[model samples]
Target: MSGRIDPEFLRFPFRRVADAALHRALEHGAQHAAFRFAHTLEASWRLRDGRPAGTRSTTTTGFGVRVLYDGVPGFAAATEVTAEAAASAAGRAVETALAARPLAVGRISLAPEPVHRDRTWIAPYERDPFDVPAGEITALLADYSGRLGSAVGVGHTDAMLQVARETTFYADTAGTSTLQQRVRVLPEFTAHREDPAGELVSLRTVAPSTGRGWEYLTGTGWDWDSELAELPMLLEEKAGAPAVEPGPRDLVISPTNLWLTLHESVGHATELDRALGHEAAFAGTSFATPDLLGRLWYGSPAMNVTADRTAEHGLATVGYDDEGVAAQRWDLVRAGVLTGFQTDRGSAARCGAVRSTGCSQAGAFDQQPLQRMPNVSLAADPAGPDTEGLIARVEDGLYVVGDGSWSIDSRRQDFQFTAQRFHRIRDGRLAGQVRGAAYRSTTKDFWRSLEAVGGPQTYLLCGAFHCGKGQPVQVAPAGHGSPSALFRGVDVVTTRGGAPW
Candidate 1:
């Protein structure tokens, strides 16, 4: 709630535009209206080998108006920030709603919510990444890449850093208003080496982006020095190791890899809109239909998941969603059964829920908001063992770290995932690094195979930007938290189609 809020958060004429837009919408016979504005600044620096390869930055600003007119919804947006433009957009939004009323699927019924007033929420941060000098940013990237490139067998190194600051304002005719700002950063490094097979192999860092500022890159959340020093050795070991033997094998998956699995399988699958078959295309419909709510066994009894928007430094953490509903935490799975879904005010009402879970989000002012995924995470068992302990419990298996390429059906059921690095495990110990390993399984079968998870000490918050959805393809940021997990008898494959040798 307290931090260095970006000046751009308040520089816009939020109240003036909102008043004009709402007044006009009401005059046009709209029952409800909301005004929204957003500004985002993004910058990135990249290094190759030992020198700067590229650098770029961009800024975008826009405002939009939305209205509920005679049981239908309409939206319009513009780059103009004036009150006059907002009023015009409001009128157009009402017109759009009127035009669609005749063909509307069903009457819109939004869940009731308490009006929140005079609210200001700022993402926690110590230093602003944007405020850092460009020279400093490039110097850091170059230095990291150079250090890695100097290592033996390290033929090439790539380093990059990207930062973004998003500011938003919202005001609804229901007497809710919120101004918010968030800062996020992502930094990555990779090393390449030629393997004994004379094929180039690559390995990258496993650190995930978070809702933090410049401080994150400077050793706040991650141990950069240790990771950089270990990269070359890890890559060297991986390049010469044998290709994974494909078959059913016991596996211990690190949180770095598990977070993405949760994001794709559990997080996206449980969205109310997708589950109810009201949203589709960008991501396919969900198999967890309404009829299965509280009936489907999503996983083993060890699987417990929560959808939240208020975890510290979480990418999706916020005080309020685009719909003017307060952020909340709710169970998605309990004792391995479907318990709830991520919902917004409208989706909640449609699904017979009493209140919103505040999952609604829009990437920018020009886009229509939808019920998006929150920071969905698996809860760690209080008495569970640590990661090392989990590994010790595995007799013969593969241990995978970091996420790689993945694919799943639109139903979020059957899927395959590869990782940055995999190590063969024999007799409860890692034998050596292995190359070209991927795991394939259905969502239900995979989760059911989960035998145990590391305790809270092994949990990590990880996620990415650019979660894409909707027709025009709106992108949102999200987070997922998980612990090192053990899965019994999982199918493993070699990317190069190798057999046991």
Candidate 2:
């Protein structure tokens, strides 16, 4: 069942503490201030060969204050939940900002945002995972693993479940106050096989991590039983499959694999911070520079993409960002041209946008918010073909599914991605499974080669729990939805020996 805000979080005197902190920061000569009280719960369980390997649970609660003094921003956090502690933290933040003002590069100016009073939002999820009995969850996972273990030629099986609940109370000097909670879970299963020659191969489930709850693992969202039953067979086939003969060939990429390509190429590249060189220390700057906006032919005319924080079941979905900017949706690429950039308050103002795109986010209460990615996704064709149809259109190519190892250049332009399974397509049909296959290309060249895309019926929402960025390192969850797509004359490579087999 869909969950409401946990009553325990409401019991915390967050509002009183936030008001006290804001009052103190303003009295300390701060231009802008924000207070965030956050509580997070995380649990992880792992199983190997039908037995529990480990299980762990963690809970953290804290509050942080951010302030701008003389155009410098500073932050401080504390685990204490008292108004006095909040005021002290705010005072310290102001002091820190004042000390750094002398050497600050430029005056901090934020984009204007309308005040939103007393707002609350909860992510769509049925059945809180934490409320479920640990024994029951473990039993289900073990049963799936046991099934896989019984498959012929299956050497071993591994399964994992990760769930998180995050609650935040945000208040700012601008009169915006919001209480938000979200739940997300990820379940994964893998089967391995080894041939007599000692060559090892494995296949993993395509079930994606999502903004769901315990129900997701209970066959509410994904078919765990069917996927688990089929994984061992797929693994067996992959182990005996021949290595791919690499060359320029057509490729039909499924949503399972294409989501990650979109994440690295379009999602990160379109962040205003990355484009303006402010985020180059951790991840390299983007090739999609601001100057190229509205002029660069980013892909084929059929290509369109959008950055959305309000997408249903999106991991990044929220009522408002850490900066109190409302969540939004906007086009980043339209008709194959660069059109927009994801932005936070400062970046939005620097980029001449009237308001932030709600891209600012922090991994936890103790961390400062950074310009992070939203749910950037490719727009599916309204009346395009299905996966089978897309494959049929390819005379000779490879059908790639499930994300595996990936490498992208600093600029997010040149890259290569391998998949969990690769099926050879010959004469407009799937020939057989192929191993050691990867596709490599420049971002623009790769997207521009898109010859067709499947319809909405084939679209899938997929994402990762850890997208690492920024100095001191922060991780954010993001989602990407894409339909099966066909690209022509792409560079297909054999990754095993760097030679065509």
Candidate 3:
């Protein structure tokens, strides 16, 4: 809502081309058609040990046309932005649809969407990252890394910043038209140390990739200075920490770590495509099959999860999905039962849904849109306690913070996750740091064991930029928000290097 679309992208005759493409598709007897022009910009910087290591920037621009001809779908994209090219792409799309009609699995039908006209929206941001001088950005990262390097007991440091801007213009035969833009940035810093015995230990910032601008790295969104100052001490403590004993125990999982759990367990598991077996080759199928909707006991009564594409600052947040469906929010799990799944127009029609949840997305203009995950988040309890209060309730448990290595089975069921840092909780207080701590549990079992969740104050929005899916492999950004949660009787394991002899 704050930033504007790139002037250069707007300078192109996108509307003229879209009108030409839509007119051609309809004149060719297509029942439905849409045109989209997209422009994307990305910049990345890396620093190691307070020195510049690498820098890169890229820009991509293109337009695509999608058409439904005689109930068969077809798509075509080209980098050329002209009225003639748009018409040509539309003709090719119709031809492709006609050629594939004989092998159609079913009559391609799209869920109905209310037409919107001449609308514009932008993701909230104060400053565009591209406008910032690269040299200035590098200097900031170096200063932060230099502080960590000068810290006692710190051996090395690494820092990086990644920023992206995306602008899109969409038009459809149904009279819906929109122009939108969004910006996102991610900053990270890690500190490393080595024990006298030559074992390595490291601590990295828990700041998640966010839908914000360059201001995020300068302390507008995260407290970088404080976190950087604390990393060295944390890394040193972890280096000498004792190993965790493997056993069933109560655990307090911080939002920093729990967000990833939500992303993998609930976010990906509840995608309609994954649940219905339409998507299997890449991330595997889901156990939350369509047949279990409204019946499967997915978690405790306190558990509630929602899939939202409208959450402010959510990495996957957008005004409209690739299918031209307006962004929406709906429940995936409510009162512990599997109630819904993230959906696109085609998937919604196939699943007997009235409308999509607006999950369709394309990583780039040249790529076809796929049913992608949205901003799936765990709802926080309004009357629940804060993180420290949740920790106080655990008599003997482990406090896990920040996500580390993780693995999940093809069914999105059985899984194990390690943490960047762990603390032994004794008698409702953090006793000391521990190393090589991990937890393993099935998706259903893990959710069922969630006894309590922290209040809104303890909730954090965090996620990854590289959530890979689809057969051709498209990486989409998504956010997962969760509160610090207490899980009862979880199986904690001691990892390889930290095993007690």
Candidate 4:
């Protein structure tokens, strides 16, 4: 257990305001209460046509109070951190809860979790990107874009860099206090070329954002220089790639592309809120009903997926969930079976789980925390063969790398995914690059078709920093680790209706 945040970070105004808010809520007859303060710093840089185009930075700070009165929950937040304002906000929250008491559901009870005080955790990073000059970041992106345009047939290129840092403080009456810091960086670029058929083709980088600092940009998790240099060559190769003939074939899907597929299909479907029919408008409910838990076959025998809130460098890693539950991990799928669901303490208690795994999250001070996703990932098979060996065994297939556009049904049962680069395979060898390729499958069929997984060396952690769900649209950062896996007899589709390349 750890104490609150550093005194330097917690100024007099912020701490005093939060203390006042909690006291006010308690005085207003709140059975339980918690206070949170957060500060986020973010910057974005974009380059187009070998020149700096856009650069921006933003900062936001706020504090919020959550209260339970007569077993009904209420919340209120304020950007202004004055003691008087904080007390008034808490008073308002109590009033709101009392007004809604008549319509309240069952009593609110959070699952018991270990107390963690006098502890501190920070995301791994060498240099803080925020301290760097904005112009320097733009110059780096522009340099990469310039190199991409040097290709003979390449027309234009786009480069982007993003860095973000978050500081959070949590306190609850149950004797828990956690102060945490998180960092993330994302660098991406794209190159486009025109062909004789009056069509345009493009290629993009295959790297993912991570919980690191400027070190990630320079070359920590990824080799930015090498990847930047290879972009032009890969783009050229893709420009001349042939379109695939639609048919069922063996497919090797890379972590770069599988991450997003997991995001849309597996990630959202496992949310307890979605399964319990809470997310109806923003998207339809999931097919993963509570009735299917522990019974549904989610994948092949080699499949294992874990939902984690404490994986180092994972975007969702945190010391404690928004609901004051300490961070934890649990199995979502094991040996092809649905074993668990993403849950908050409330849902966990309702579902009779002994304890919650700390999946609760709120995008901002004003939003109600929900059972958000953690770093859900497919475990690599330690005994499995490597990707190259799997390719050697394939008589015919397509190797899909990186993610492009994707479409899936509202229920997350059916989907079609395109790739940034596709390599055709014939007789256990890479034939060449291919374009106009997409793989479609029902969720069950897709996972069931998975025949083999690559070894740990081929596994990569990749994910988006922004996954949107819920009304008012909360965004959470998440990552997925997976290896290149072979699927048997997946349906392939070719572009039609004069589609753009």
Candidate 5:
């Protein structure tokens, strides 16, 4: 029920329409012109205690015309899929750029990129969730929920599945054309138990979404059977777990929880636009500015971070960005030193970078491409220990697993993070679980305190499904890969008293 090509999307006369738009813009005295057609499909299915909760599937298809005229960039889009509409939009885009020429703060400039011709890339996956019948999916959700909800000490169960497929076609006047597609899936289930105090204690699956297909939930990527079987007992133990004592202690952070820490502290802080103060919205400007590049000690000597759009199965992986820059991998932090920043064509030109890192991303056809995030990862030490081995080294500490909630300043510096499960580690062994645990530290101090990192086997790719940015607020997916890491002398707090803001 799956195929490598999207016949429905290919059926559209996108090439004919894109050529029309490009021709129109060039004829209208435009210095540069590009046309893009994008189609996105999103599906979600949910169940609560073996009963249908909600289901939705949405499809968005549109085309946009962008032109560089009179030294400024302008963009226009239309839902209509026709050459005439695309040509009209091209003319309007050029007019808008001409009208705004007087108000433009600076003449637009782009970093040089080699022309890419007739390139196509599709993310590797075997099954399309869309191909599965709705009734079959519903039955699967119901069965998973029914098993959990009926378990001992488990009063409620919730499960959900979300999947997306994006198909795009881009053609520019400069002899660059690309057709690309990406598919991703997210599936999760949660088990809840009512404690004696009438409060609900819950635990959720550690596996989040990945750049895979329907096979992800069917034992291709994660083992649902083992997780479901063990969830009820874990929930029962956690419900009666004692509250953690607040103090400075050694901490072992699993990738499930550490990935979010990386996303907040390192990912957003390294966006070149955010650092330059050109754009500030969701997370605000960064503390890691151009002035500190190549000098700032971002972490311990054990730390090495890379921003890449070329990693296999990376959610941000792309063949080419909107600016026609090929995907690349660059160092953001190497041996604890700030080495690079995420850059698009504009940011690369401003920052004296020779080329864009291929990070220019647009969430949809209508949205202007922004210097967005890429798959930022903390590299694992080649010869380091595994998670269990790292845990065995701790005399007294807390092992944090699964992301819970996070609080960080606009600068992405000072932050506190909580986790879904915190186990007390004593004398090289896990004693039991602890409740109401959180770790608080400044971004710099936290990274600098890194004691050790686990080997590749302990690494995991984890991130949020959506990250919001821009004045109009556009969101795109982001990823962070990390190994189980150990940090020394971090302040652990009890969040039961309420948020320690």
Candidate 6:
């Protein structure tokens, strides 16, 4: 069942409504039409001082209509789930297309694709987190916080859990009908020790968001017991490690820390919208310009990156995108060269491609579908060595693990990232833990500096559940997988107030 697409979701009543809506739009002279019905539930839990601090749950449902007339596209949506409302939406969509005719640069055409109907998918998970008692979750987090914060020099400890379930029904005039259900859970905790004397250090769990369920909280994909046991000790060590001196040195970055780099540099840069300069507002744009698609050197020959829409446990995994295109996997960077772009149906046609990579999405039913990201990841070299082996190749360097404060320019180029913990390496061995360390580099220069990548054993799939973009500010969840990697002498800086304060 893992590789097979299930058709069970069409059994829901929403599918019937979607079918009728699509038919309604096409009957109204729409050259292309799509109907999307979505139901999403989100729950958030926060704990402070061995008790529940806050808890919130939100549920949203609606349907949208998209249409294409003689070379222009328009979209309209309604909260009402009636056939008449859908027809009205289709009518308004045509009006919008006419109004935007002058602004459209060229004929709006979509890449052609074969139709698939009655297909379905459900993200793999054991227990649904939404079904778990909210009180039980809060109690666990509160207990963990209380035990850790009670220690000396500990100022505060906080924990949170976020669970979401999304069910969607999509139908198009081309005879494709797809239904999907996915669940994602994010469990996180931060234990911070602060002193009024201006010293503070915090340690957080490394549990990234995943397409899982309640079992994730208990112990399905993560070992909550072990991570909690080590939080207090790690926090104490970080509090005492010597403040680092800024200088150039070799770097061995763990998968936990490298995932963010992949997200900013590779993930956003390859987005078809960013590449085409459509994301110029808050989401910025891309440095991987169209002219550099096949010629640019993105990284070292050891680097292999892919944009996957079907990765297991990936938050972005779906049966079909909002544009009614099936999911796919395509390369973004291969052997350091820019190989492909993450694209939607319209964007693919604009880019002279034959089909979409299925990167289209709408944050909610009220929003219009736009080019979005998938599970953009750096594939590990299975035949290579592990993290320890890579570290052993360096006589003098720093081993950076976990994530910390990060900053990247609007161009997704110049950036500086700090790590949760830094360990000094001398004579190919870990010497001591160091505090206040950061690394900075331009996007191109940084990736080109890749020295080696660890084997599969060192790979970790990590990502955030909230990647925001677009004018109305739609947030999407994405995943990035990578193995521990080594880089040659890179610019290392200490976060010890470089500017005169």
Every candidate's CA RMSD: 1.3, 1.1, 1.2, 2.4, 1.9, 2.7
Write down the TM-score of every candidate. Answer: 0.98, 0.98, 0.98, 0.95, 0.97, 0.94
Question: Over 4 Å off in model 2, which ranges?
Answer: 498-501
How do the residues 11-42 of candidate 4 rate in per-residue lDDT, one tens digit apiece? 73666776788889888899878778788777
The global Cα lDDT (0 to 1) of model 2 is 0.91
lDDT of 3 by residue, 1-501 (tens): 388779999899999999999999999999999898999998999999989999999999999899999889999999999999999999999999999998998897899998889889899999999999888999999999999999998989999999999999989999999898999898889988887678777899998899999889888879888888888888888888887888998999998999889989999999888898888888799999999999999999889999899999999999998888899888999978999999999899998889988898888887778999889999999999999999999899999999899999999999999989999999999998987789999999999998988899998889887789886788889999999999999999878763352
Write model 5 residue lDDT over 277-396, tens digit each, in one string: 877656689999999999999999989999988776677877899878899999999999999999998889988888889898888998878888999999999999999999998999
lDDT of 1 by residue, 390-465 (tens): 8898888999999999999999999999999898889888999887789999999999998898899999999867
- Model 1: residue 99 alpha-carbon error in angstroms: 1.2
Specify the highest-lDDT model's number: 2
**Which clashing pairs does model 3 show?**
1-122
For model 2, the run of ten residues with the poorest summed lDDT: 492-501
List the candidate 6 regions with Cα displacement exceeding 4 Å: 1-13, 150-153, 195-198, 498-501
Model 6 / residue 290 / CA error / Å: 2.5
Report the Cα lDDT for residue 284, model 3.
91
Lowest-lDDT window of 10 residues in candidate 1?
Answer: 1-10
Cα lDDT, all candidates: 0.89, 0.91, 0.90, 0.83, 0.89, 0.83
The clash tally of candidate 4 reads 8
How high is the lDDT of residue 274 in model 6?
Answer: 86
